[model samples]
Target chain A: MEWFIAKIFAKYNYWISIILMMIGFYGIVAKDNLIKKIIGLNIFQTAIFLYFISLGAVKAGTAPIVDAEIIRKGYVYANPLPHVLILTAIVVSVATTAVALSLVIRMHQEYGTIEESEIIEKSRDKGMTWT
Target chain B: MIVSIDLILLFFVVVIAIAAITLRDLLSAVILLGAYSFLMALIWVELQSVDVGFTEAAVGAGATTAFLVATISRTVRWEKK
Candidate 1:
């Protein structure tokens, strides 16, 4: 029972992250505005980042800082690989957001509105084939 | 991170995300996204990823907000009903 409390119950980050991910997914799928959809995508990505970072935590472990004393003490270092990967992923996410927002800007300039449904309707009205 | 702090941060992040999606003004939503990114950075630092938190704070909150503002300025602010 104590082990359960110490292990499973201590790892609560995963469940909340799942909920957050769903909210982002909902935004991407259901929102009418392109910006809102993009916001949702950001939210979803953040949630994934949270989950991945959480997975890197070690029980009774310290941060992955290399110190001679700590090494002699044999302290367990939390996995640093996920942290590095997520760092790169965050940058990529920002780059992706920039590109996606620029596309929205173009869509707005052409269609005069950023709503997904309206853009589709306007494109069809203009006789442009949008697959 | 303290469990209580972690819970509070997570709760606020979730609330802000919901607000960001539901808000009508694109500018306000963009601002909320900046706030969201800042909170996410704090969460990362708490998770022992200080480097990731720094990138998120600088790029996610900073550059992303700038790009969003530019896009909004060049396009529109309010979502049409």
Candidate 2:
């Protein structure tokens, strides 16, 4: 039963991460709203984070902290580098989200709506082409 | 080893993602996207990356969702088909 649980946990983790990523990408591509696109972007980035964190796991490993006693006993420790990188990634994600939301707000004020299709339609009508 | 639980979780994640994309309501899509993130975080936790899992929970499930919802509230909530 324990072995079954472990396998289930590991496989589930991988599949969940992948599905979230694909969905996020689909949202970004298929959604017409700028805000919704940003949300999808966040979801995509988060799936990557989950994948990396999962890769860092070590079975039966303890925290990376150097406990004097544990060191003397020579116990295995989990990798800490991924954790550190993830912290940085988290900060970057927050900053990106902020910038994206701000851009959405600006788009709303200028275009009067946040729908990508509507904005494109209006711009096309204006004959002001911008790639 | 029964990998069934993970398969179930994976199935749910896929369903949520599909729902998020297929829904006409932008608000519902955003909410489902948030649910997707939360599920991803749980996967991270199961993999034993406590720190990464915590970060996902905070930034993905919390901050990102809030940002999306706030932006939606300030703009239109539906896309015309």
Tens digits of lDDT, candidate 2, A6-82:
88765555666787788789879988767667767877887787677766767666656678898899887767888
Report per-prediction Cα RMSD to one decimal.
2.2, 4.5
Q: Which of the numbered candidates is closest to the native, going by highest DockQ? A: 1
TM-score of each: 0.92, 0.79
The native-contact fractions of the candidates, in order shown, are 0.71, 0.63
- Report the lDDT of model 2 for residue B19: 77
lDDT of 2: 0.76
Clashing pairs in 2: A3-B1, A4-B1, A4-B2, A8-B3, A12-B6
Model 1 ranges off by over 4 Å:
A1-9
DockQ of each: 0.73, 0.45
Q: How do the residues B1-81 of candidate 1 rate in per-residue lDDT, one tens digit apiece?
A: 567888999899989988998899999999999999999999888877788888999999999999889889998899877
